[model samples]
Target: MRSSDFCIAGGGIIGLTLALELHRRGAEVTVVERDIPLKQASQAAAGMLAVRDPDNPPELLPLSELSIDLYPAFLDRIERLSGQRVPFQTTVTYQSVGHSSLRPAINLPTGLIPGDDGLSRLEEHSLDPRQLAPALLTAVRNTSVVILDHTTIESAPPAGCLISTLGPWGAPPAAPRKGQMLAVSVPASFGLDYVVRTEHIYIVPRLQGPRAGQAVIGATVEDAGFSTHTEPASLARLRGLAAAFLPAVADETDFPIVDHWAGLRPYTPDNLPMLGEIEAADPGSTKRFVATGHYRNGILLAPATAHVMAELLTGEVPSVDLCRFAPGRFGKA
Candidate 1:
């Protein structure tokens, strides 16, 4: 039998980050994952750190902003400990409007500037999730956190002070929404330095390595449960959307379709994460905390969620208000 003062189920970013925090506070920590750690939603994410996203509801803006503010420190710590380049690049988001439509004068939010492409340019940031996962995994491995890969944890309250970061597979049932995306190579003069988003799609440019000039075109949100299949039709639609935003990308058919992939986002009914303690079936049982249902913001919110959960586990009040994310908020999760 495995034992630890803190056993975290699901070693995605949230689980790993929380485990690191708890271990730093002198707790024995073990993380159990169904597959390789950081290979799930954490790795598949596009890593857009958009706090003041045009679409974010006002109620959740503070948490999102807090998480974005916390990212710099989080990335620095991981880089210091793991010695891996966790790429975080500050960029702009060009929210595109349809051609021929009269451009409405938008009261641009803070950090947003008017753009030339019939779009609003919002100063934002992004990182490569592919790089982040490994850096986090490496950092945790350097610590006292025990990671059990390829191990499925089945028992309820799996261990003492259990924290479930099992996205889409935990209580309250976060449904898996699949998204299809594709990456294409870019020419030297691609003239694209920022992310571009329409209501239906987003094009995020890559910053480093061989794919440096390339950009990722995504995604189609479908209510396909846990299915990671890359649909050609969805990819084509994404490509079409990318073309609508950047006409140059469509003109170059020979750049080569670099990669195509899909990932399942954990979407809750309320679209808020479940945090805090689980109400034990038997009142006398030990406490089990949950931290999941982040949907598309998992990458953006990991630091704050880990910090909050770590604070709660250590018998301290979280700096951030979490009343909206209480585990039992959605009918006894």
Candidate 2:
């Protein structure tokens, strides 16, 4: 029988990050994926570290704060271990406010926004997940981490502990929020460098490496169950939204539509990720744990999620309170 200190059931960013942390602590780790690593929402993420996004749940604030703080060190470790460069695409996010009663200011110091008409420029960060994925994969491969790609894990893997980072595959009391996103390559002088967000859509620009001049326009969140299919109509609507914000995207002659894709995000009823031990099944069963249902914040929450999970597995005190994200809260997750 194969033995490992941990056998994680998902090979996405969350699983891989947590596996790396565990292996760093001298644990034998094996990551099992149903298909391949970084093939799902991991690569599809816009890579926004939106710690100050007002739309986020209030319960997520503490974790988000810890995550954004850990981001620099996280990327640094990934690059150092993998021998790759994953630079931040942007350091500011401009959130547009419509003509209405003004909301509370975001409380972020800002200088001159390129076009600061009615946008709230916040101190945020963004990166290209496409770049992050390969670095993380390479880093894990360079370690003692054993990755079982194209492998389906049983309910309980033969390990001292089993962590279910398995996105929506077996999530409970949760549904897959399908998202459609498209990307376009603009000229270096595209006149836009920061991330942009409106009520319905977001635009993120890449500022470094071969990905520079690439802007990603995303994301239609639908209740479509596990549909990997991208709708042309939806893509057109997304393009229209982008054009409304930046008219340059409408002209395909100058800026070409490079890629389009669809993926599913695991979201719980409360919209909070399920983390921590599976206490409901057996009060004493620390052998099984879950860390899924991150929904739209998986990219933002990856490093923090791994940090806490590793602490939990190693019997160390968690950095943040996990009461609000307890798995099995909806009955035996």
Candidate 3:
């Protein structure tokens, strides 16, 4: 039997980031993943690192702030150690009610304002998940870390500790929320350089050059667990919403379809992610830790989550207070 000081399930962004952190701390780590690192939702994600958006729940603000602060240094460290640039850019994210509605200016603690165009400027940024996930996997591969791809984690083996970083949709069937999305190639003239979010639709610009101009459209949340089917009615509603927000996109193509996909986002009832230790079901075990249920913020929160997990594993003092996010917050301790 193979053995390591730590074993992480789910090779998505969160899992890989945790592995990297543990390895850096001098603990032998092994990652067991079900899919090739970027082929799932991690690759399909638009990679918008928006934290200051007005729509975000207040309880999540601390985690969001921590992630935003950690991103630059996180990217720098990854590049220096892995020798690959993870493309990241800080830009103004916009949220508008309607083209004609008077955009209400929201006062933010960060001092950003709602611009004249009736859109709030969120101190947010984006990264190419397609590029970032693969780069992380490659970096892990180059190190002493072990990666097992194309294998599902049927059960957890007894260990000194176990961390579950599985996202919301990754939980058991009863707790899953399926998210549907699509990617399309647009003309350079579309000129959508910023992330736009409305009540019904969101448009995220791809890091690929302007010529190949790409964006992800249609993110309908449904109760269907892990279903990847693209419903025509939902697609039409999304396109209509997009057209209402950006007339230019509506004028360009009636049917701007490209690639459609879906994935389950592990969602808790309250919409906050579940983190921290799970006392073993058996009284004799040492400790079990979980860092899962991060629905859309998986990419944005990866670094902070990894750091917290490492601190918990090593018995070091944690820099941030994790009491609120404890896995036990979900139910009976």
Candidate 4:
């Protein structure tokens, strides 16, 4: 039996980041991932570090702010360890109000700038998850971390306190959500330096050297189970939304199609992540813990989550109040 101090399931950003943190704190960690790190939602994400005043939930703001602040240092540490530069830009994001009566004018501060045309400023700032994920994985791997790919958690460990980071699982009946997304290649002339968001559309720029001139546009939330299938209907809906917000892309012939994909974002009734430890079956035992349910903020909250998890594992008091995100908060009432 493979043994380690900690075993993390789902190697995406959150799992990998936690692995790195655990390793940094001198704990041996084994990560079991179902697929490649960036191939899932972590790669498909537009990498927006948003905190729109309107969208910010009072309970989650503190955690969000803490994560945002730790990003710079996080990136620096990853780069130093992996020797790869992760691009992070403080661009202005805009939220264009459309004429559709379906929704009202909504503005929010995002960490990305809208490069497409005809979008008004709502908020902006940006980070490249594509670059960040690989950088982090590389750093962890360099430290002799073990990651088992294409492995699923058929069943939780029978003994150690099982901490479920599985986004869609809670208590008993699990409800997983699926999201769709697309990647398009744009010419160097696109000149879109900011991330743009409309009532239902968002566009982010590519940060890799090879795809530097392109942009990744997408993301449609659906209740289609945990399947990551990119259906034509969803792609059409996304393209239509993009064209409406950026009139310039209305001509399909002018824009080059690159890639299309989809992923699952774990959702819960409260939409807040689950964190903390589980008491061992033996009444006085304290052996297992969890830091999951981050949903979409998994990337943004990775650093803080790692820090908190490390504190828990080391018996050190965490610097922040975890009461709001306590895993037991959602226990059966």
Candidate 5:
């Protein structure tokens, strides 16, 4: 019967980040997770800080830029608290322009990211999730915030208010879209310094640790409804997508898939995050709130989400407009 001021429903990156912020504001917090924290989308992400990705909704741009802006300080805090270096990967992404809908970065004029071999170079920020996730987990553990792993919020001492940061369980009460990804080792001579992304695939080279020569390729978005199953056909298709950019990955004998995984992304009907308080479950009980349904942008939006959610929780006006992301949006119109 542990108790706290706020009990977070999920302990993924979003959850932990919010917890850190809330705690900073002097709120005693508790986090309840069904499984390990960061085991979901946070761990499965490609860690691309795709702030200017043209595919993102227009309403998301401000928040995206805000998050990317805060990334440096956020990473610093994580490193300071956890005492671990979350290795950085690259500061640029090479987006394939051929047969792709990608507009110039920041809607710049034509030839912004110069295209070569049908590929365009865009300045993007990316980090190694393998390093970030663990460091985040360690950072949280070092904090006074209570974490109840392998448990649900219901088990925590009843709190009048609850916020859900459960990444894929759909805090906005939406569906979970599954994504599958894989990584393969590349040779040093390959000199894959920056991120290489096609229409639907991205190849990121690791430059640190034992994974130095490995390139991470991802992912497949599926409305599979919480299914954890990874399909060979899906992986093969991703490999083919990667092959279009780096022919060497196509040869399993040469690259050899070192690791493969599947994760769920929270998907809302509007494809926007729901970041406001949930209407009271009962006339005067259960003041619920949701900070989920980030879909493909959870990793990218974490800092912004945490900042805005903290502002909302602390009764301060969120610095960014959240009307487009209200939890009850679907019920409107």
Candidate 6:
């Protein structure tokens, strides 16, 4: 029966960021989570801040670009508020090309040359999700945000503006697309300075410090329907992919798979996030809003989503075109 100016369902990264934003604008906010906050997709992400990725839908480019530009300020604000250092870096992302795409005239790491293929370097960055999740939680707790973890919502709450950030398994057009990932320990001799990505896998090196010489290797997309089970076959597949590109990972006898996990990304038919208000469930009822269906970009797109959502909720005009993301576009699907 808790209430506030806004009630957010699904306390993942998107939900926590939205709460932080709305609370900054002087709104009392409550976040409800089915499990501990940041234990789902947000925790499982490799935290790549990428907009120019080939995998990104063209329609999502504008939103992605906007979010990338806001990262600096977002990190600065959160770090100051939370009093925790978020491991982040602005490094190049080397996209490995095979015989199918891009010219093969370029050389890659380990004296690996692409025959009729090459590598494309883009200005990209990454954050350590292990650090980010806790920092975000700290920032939210420092605010007036009320978090009701281990709670589930049967329907929209009876009061306040309800905003749903529930990832997959929540509403229609938003279903679970399971992804499996693993983290491996690399040796100090393993010289991987930038994020490396081929068609199948990505390797993001950890920032220097006590956790230096480690990288996260992932992931496999499966339509297993809300399942987070980790299979050895899938882990082996990811390991093979990692070793194929970064031979150093395999050559280093000490580089062993330290951890593995799976998470569900919220998938939508159009592959675009749903934002804006849900038309009143019944006449004269309080309106609801949604900011889910981000899929794999949830961590990358969080700050921007929170910004625009706060704008919309506070009656301030959002700068971006949200028409395409409206829930009515699905028409009760």
The numbered model that scores best in TM-score is 6
Per-residue lDDT over 1-333 for candidate 3, one digit per residue giving the tens place of the 0 to 100 score: 367788787788888888888998999887777766646667767688868655556777887788878888878767776788887643756776445565554543132233334665565688777778767877888888788777565544334566666565354321666777776666765456777776556878675533136777758878885567878777767766676656555543633677777776667776777777776678886566777777777788888888877988899877678887776765654
Give the per-residue lDDT of model 2 (tens digit) for 129-207.
Answer: 9999999999999998889888877633478888889888866775789999988887866667778787778989888
Query: Mind giving the per-residue lDDT tens digits that candidate 1 earns over 30-112?
Result: 89898888877887777788786666556678778788888888888898889987776547776765453646336543333
TM-score of each: 0.90, 0.91, 0.86, 0.82, 0.91, 0.93
Q: Against the hidden true structure, what lDDT does model 2 obtain? A: 0.84
Candidate models: Cα lDDT each: 0.79, 0.84, 0.70, 0.67, 0.81, 0.82
Clashing pairs in 2: none
TM-score, candidate number 6: 0.93
Q: After superposition, how far is residue 261 of candidate 2 from its true place, in Å?
A: 0.7
Which residue pairs in candidate 5 collide?
none
Q: What C-alpha lDDT, on a 0 to 100 scale, does residue 65 get in candidate 4? A: 79
- Which residue ranges in model 1 land beyond 4 Å of their true spot? 97-118, 155-158, 252-254
lDDT of 4 at 61: 77
Stronger candidate by TM-score (3 vs 6): 6
Who is ahead in TM-score, 4 or 6?
Answer: 6
Q: Write the per-residue lDDT of candidate 6 for residues 154-270, one digit (tens) a residue.
A: 543444788889989578989988889888887656566778777678888886544566788888989999789999999888888887766656654678877889999999988
Runs of candidate 6 with Cα error greater than 4 angstroms are 97-116, 154-158
Instruction: Give candidate 6's error at residue 94 in angstroms.
Output: 0.3
Q: How close is candidate 2 to the true structure, as a TM-score?
A: 0.91
Candidate 5 positional error at 209, Å: 3.1
Off by over 4 Å in 3: 97-118, 152-158, 168-174, 209-212, 252-255
The lowest-lDDT stretch of 10 consecutive residues in candidate 6 is: 108-117
Clashes (backbone N, CA, C under 3 Å), per candidate, total: 0, 0, 6, 14, 0, 2
For residue 205, what is the lDDT in candidate 5? 78
